[model samples]
Target: MESETIQEPLDRFLVSVERKAFVMARMATRDTDEALDIVQDAMQALVEKYAGRPEAEWPPVFYRILNNRIRDWHRRQKIRNLWRGWLKPWSESNDRNDDPLEQIQDPGVVDPGEGMDRKASMARLEVALANLPLRQREAFLLRAWNGLDVASTAVAMGCSVGSVKTHYSRAIHTLRQFLEEYRP
Candidate 1:
């Protein structure tokens, strides 16, 4: 009975965070499967390692685990890319046909133009986000998208609050420049 009480709020918390965490991971990885795997790993790590902590502490802890997982994934990718580059002469061309946009569902709106505009705007925002440096992107997503405050974002990012502010500011400036043409 005590275990059930503990598990219920944890489950709710995970559910509430799942989609945004997946989006954050997806933006970082640019691959759906990798993003899903990272989010799952983060969730499992949180449950296994931090379940006993106070509920108020969960967000920063969970995000910290998630960011660590993302960083590790990037490190592994870099190593893999290095090996692939070395083996390039013997390997076939690495062409991928998967278009991330194709996976988006129709909004089912009455006005076709509205949906198209929304998609175009989203595409522009995504491009801007993808162009940011990893640290900047992480700061922006954690602070702006995830709604984590500066101190919590610093904790999640494993960085100082000043660093988070600088990264997030740079990310916002860069994004604004990139998407300036789309502004109304």
Candidate 2:
């Protein structure tokens, strides 16, 4: 019975976070498969390692684990790219033809034109976010998208509060500049 009590909230928390976490990971990785794997790994790590913590502490702990996983993925990609460069220097191509925007849909929307406008705006935002430096992007997403406070964001990012503030401020400025034309 006691175990059931503990498991219930954790299950609820995971379910609540899963979609947002997947979106965050997808934005960071720009690869659907990689993002799914990262979110799954983060969820597993949180359940295995931090399940005993108070519910109030779960957000920071889970996000910290998720961000760490994303960072590790970036590191691994860098190493792979380095080796691939050495092995096939001439074949390197940065072009990606897939349009991720086409995959996004909102079935609940009643108007197709409004939905297209929304999707276009979201695509521009995503591109601006993708262009941000990793630390700035992490800070922005954790604070803005995840609704985490400054201290919680600091904890999630494994950075000082001041660093989180600085990164987030820079991210906001850069994003505002990038999306200026889209503004009404």
Candidate 3:
């Protein structure tokens, strides 16, 4: 009974962040299935390893687990691709339907013009973010999108505060340059 009380907040927190975390993972990996797997693994790791920790510590710890899982996935992919490179004749082409990140047009907006324009701008920003270097993207998303402070983001990224600042600053500058014409 007491354990449930302790777990309730953690459960709520996980629910709150799950979708954003999956989107972040998807954006980083560009592979929907792998991103889903990574998020699941991160959540499991957080539950198993850090569930007993204070709630205040949960966000950074969970994000750190997520970032580490993403790195591990990328590392495994690099090795697999290397082996595939040596045995290229058996390679199969990917089907287009497997992508889960495709943006769907919404039908429920009250103001179609405003909603369409907003969606278009958001799509462009998403593309620009996906094109950013990994560290820069991570910094920007953690600080701006996920709303983590510099110290917390540093903890999550396993980097120093100065590095977070530098990465975040560079990311903002790059986005401004890339999306200069996206202003409403």
lDDT of 1 at 17: 93
Estimate candidate 3's alpha-carbon lDDT, on a 0 to 1 scale: 0.85
Per-residue lDDT of 1-184 in model 2, one digit per residue for the tens? Answer: 8567789999999998999899888888889999999999999999888898899999998999999999999999999989999999786375654453344344345557877676666767787887688899999999999999999999999989999999999999998886786553
RMSD score of candidate 3 (Å) = 4.2
- Candidate 1: residue pairs that collide: none
Tens digit per residue, CA lDDT, model 3, 133-176: 88899899999999999999999999999999999999999888
Note the Cα lDDT for every prediction shown: 0.86, 0.87, 0.85
Scanning candidate 1 in windows of ten residues, the lowest lDDT window is 96-105
Clashes in model 3: which pairs?
none
Ranking by lDDT: 2, 1, 3
Q: Model 1: per-residue lDDT, tens digit, 26-103?
A: 988989999999999999999988988999899999999998999999999999988998978565544643453444
Which candidate has the highest TM-score of all?
A: 2
* Candidate 1 displacement at residue 65 in angstroms: 0.7
The better-scoring model by lDDT among 1 and 2 is 2
| CA shift of 164, model 3, Å | 0.3
Deviating ranges (above 4 Å) for candidate 3? 89-117, 181-184
